[model samples]
Target: MKQEQFLSVVDRDEAERRFRAALEPLGPLGVEEVALAGALGRVLAEDIASPVDVPGFDRSNMDGFAVRAEDTYGASEQAPRRLRCLPEPVVMGVLPVGEVTEGTAMAIPTGGVVPRGADAVVMVEHTRLDGDHVLVEKPVTPGRAITWAGTDIAQGEVVLRAFDVLSSRETGVLAAMGVDRVGVVRRPRVAILSTGDEIIRPGTPPLPGRIYDSNQVILADAVREAGGEPVPCGITPDAPEAVRAALLDALAVADLVLLSGGTSKGPGDLNVQVLAEVLAPPGILAHGVALKPGKPLCLAASGRKGVVVLPGFPTSAIFTFHEFVAPVLRILAGRARPARLHGGEADGARTWARLPVSLGSDGGRTEYVLVRLTEDAEGAAIAYPIGKGSGSVTTWSHADGYFVIPREVERVEAGERVEILPVAGVRPRRVDLVIIGSHCVGLDVVLARLAQRGVSSKLIAVGSEGGLAAVRRGECDAAGVHLYDARTDSYNTPFLEGGLVLVPGYGRLQGVVFRAGDARFEGREAAEAVRAAAQTPGVVMINRNRGSGTRALVELLLEGTRPAGYAVEASSHHAIGAAVAQGRADFGVAIDIVARERGLGFLPVREERFDLVVAASRVERPGVRALIDELASEEVRAALRGRGLLA
Candidate 1:
């Protein structure tokens, strides 16, 4: 059968509008009563009512004697009153044997039942224990120490609202209400597959021009976080038949089948083309999107299986999933978006106060820059960007929330405060992390990995000396630096000698980036284009800002020459390759490993040591300790392999 194709291919926005318009609320998918102890992070399907009154009876909050309020009306500490303690007021949960007349008292313990005739409970601290009876010296008032039945919870009252995601407190509340089980929404099962021959698993060593498969790991985490049960089906070949089989198999057990990679319009796009043919008619709803990074998305409904084809890149995959799939699955599970304060995007307001730290722009697309925020002495919020540029998955890890700068404008200058929307909450606590040195590609990767290990790290790509200054001022927890002392040929230590201790971290490699089959060719001939790139008009040279290890390396490679004034200077290593990938830049300075991943060419440059430095006081912090261990792990070295910096 011939594959079905599209009529009008629109962009990301139109695709979202179409897909969202077609979504219908999942009708009563059924529910299960999960144990209260196991209900944390689960969405409550309905309002759970209290079957019975909490406490069930009038109870004493303290010990001593239960007495009538009228009997002790004139009693006081100085003018104390003594009352005879009655022996028979019945135990808790049992009816009183005999009701006492007024002017009498009975001994009661904390949480003990208050007899029917007693109006209040007096603590034992206020009574004297005599031979066979207790004497009350303090006055008692009606309902002073009594908790009336149904006071804590009313009968058949709604304890938790429907569509509420349960937190630990909610679970505890359910348990307190004597609920053993509760009905919760069913978790949607999603199957994920990483495609492309060039992508390998992290455990596998790279061969020739190949790289590790990180899409599965990242996408899986994002899925689980978004309330889906992710089933990673591992990496598959680029062949259309293999992809088809994987989708069919995943369709059997999953509500959604997500295939990563092979969506780009290159020769590899055969998978997308094949999907159109195989899942045609009532199947493929839309292919390609208006979204920036994840523009080449695919959405289809085949039988009971809904397929979402995401871009192979990590950040794009994450963004698209959050914006699209997450909302849908949450709807299916009867979930509501948690109330958060976005403060909306900036309006006509000019730059407010100083932004605490400097930040970059989003170019044209809607940008999300995760930031760490803190209040100043006057309690005003100060946003510190973890880093700009979404390509590095790690930046998202280190950020508390991203300060949004929408597409219509150009840039937010230094000291110009902006509204930073948090990744988690509107008022996230200030995390203590100090990142120093040049901003390179995927430095956020290192931060992301650190976060997975349970660290609340924040990154600021300050220069080497700049980081040292921040360290001396006690502003950051740890600073990342790759500053080279030409005399000693080492990184960070010399600058931080008096202020902090430099911890040797693994090295990441730097190289010149170009597209494949460029006329520039290889070796020394490649240098001709590389050397003249800065001078060449319309040429974009993505580089780490001055003081970065990458910039240092670039200067070392160019020797006495500077970037030709005609070239465009990009902010980061990933931005460089990204610029080159979509043809924004002709060539840029970045790591060799990334060049291969984005289908770009690499021109080798010098290497530098990326170091993590901590103040003397923070050496014992758990986050820093865990980081040291990770930096020393075989897994990290394996991940770093041939990146510019050395271990």
Candidate 2:
């Protein structure tokens, strides 16, 4: 058989688009009617509007006399009012026989229907039974203690929208809406097939050079978590005929099919070839992806069925399933995207977090970095990078989450954040403080102090301008900014907009950072060193992103001459240092603390005031207050001064 191969390894975005396009024709799974008691986790196929009011009739919410509210008006213990009594009180299982007229009252119990001419119910405790009348002591207002018709739920109101996953709570809602059986999307059936000859079931004894199948169990549970039904198609040896037979069986009973192993280009690997030849037209959509662990991923579709060829290695299989298969399964199952929890209390509910250490990756390919999350001594959640080989299954069990490094980024600096999709069932701390803006070493110190107070902050390094824009749009609680206004010769305060209060932060020593012992900076002053470096041949200059205060100063120092590698932009000051330290560039602009940490020599250019700008209204909020107090505290100052970056 002719082996099928990838046309080109596409990036994550293009891969997603192709998968989505292929699955678009599958549409929603066929609808099925499920009893309310068994509807948990099922997605609704139709809007469930209430057919009738929940109570269905006007009823009493309290055991008291039902009378005109005006009769009890101004009635008090000191000056009691009396009303004529009815022959009998309102009874359960029977409506009131007669209405209470002026100066008349009737006894009513909880859940009893209210009679006509009565607008309120005065509790029995507030009234005393007399020979032929009841004496009221407390005042009662109209509609007091009375639950009117349709109070619980209104008729024709859409209680549940289509495609809503039915939680236990939602099932209760359906019950309340008088829906006994509901139409819901059928659980997507996922067929799993292992196609390697060296694989055996878990119960079987291991043989030399052979392993038990773990992908089936792992992938099956993953499908269940995403609201799909997994059907194990059993294992097939590495043969074209066997693989093809298993796939056809899977396609017969499954909405989606996953064939593990046999995807790589080898004589024994025939899953890709089978998918291309045996599957319906538009056979193989993608044969490979630019994904790190799951680079050998293969995708195909036949009519309404989608098939994915997964790598045999457990770690790679899991990663590929999560990154590629889970999302499409959710679409077929009609699961809505989970909402992000807001507020500090839900801080442990976010899917991703800030990277505490720098992570390096090759550009142009999406890399999934495995990570383990641990709370530091201060109770702040920290994600430590794990770089075990993709073939090692232990990496999956050890990882709390994994972060996807984009194709455009080569390195993520310490304190430069990333989103971490947790392992199937892991929950992370909620981001207590959201700071979107310029990255600074001094701010990192302040964050460390906050961590000591058990507060977690998420920092996004998007330059000073982006931070300010985020603050303006109310996207974040605060932003770290150090924008230098050339006109005013001042920093952050000059560029402050309305609704934002500039909190004065410590000044940082901005300078040129270069590799140690570089001859260009041996004795030259800061400005001269920069000019010399720019004019020298083979000298590469790394720079911070435009709109950064440090970048502004670098431009000021450059005057007009452009340097080699000027087009290369680093996300943060630490990134600049890391770039130069790694020999990716000759020199770059950054702060002193970061330069020293990377063992790079620094030449002081000027002190830039790095301020924290917050929404004026959030000044008293807990996280913002902690940030303000920590920044002004002596501990933060001492830590900052120790690094020689504090002013």
Candidate 1 residue spans exceeding 4 A from truth: 1-9, 25-28, 89-96, 130-134, 337-647
Query: What's the number of clashes in each of the models?
Result: 25, 5
Kindly list the per-residue Cα lDDT of model 1 for residues 56-125, writing each as its tens digit: 5556787667776666666665666666667775466666565444556777677776665565677778
lDDT value, residue 234 of candidate 2: 85
Model 2 lDDT, residue 428, Cα: 43
| Clash count in backbone of candidate 2 | 5
How do all models score by TM-score? 0.51, 0.52
Q: lDDT per residue, candidate 2, 3-92, as tens digits? A: 445757888788777877776754467799988888987988876766755455556778889887778888999898899989888999
Task: Supply the TM-score for candidate 2.
Answer: 0.52
Which candidate should be chosen as best, given lDDT against the real structure? 2
Would you list the C-alpha lDDT of every candidate in the order shown? 0.62, 0.76
Cα error of candidate 2 at position 601, Å: 87
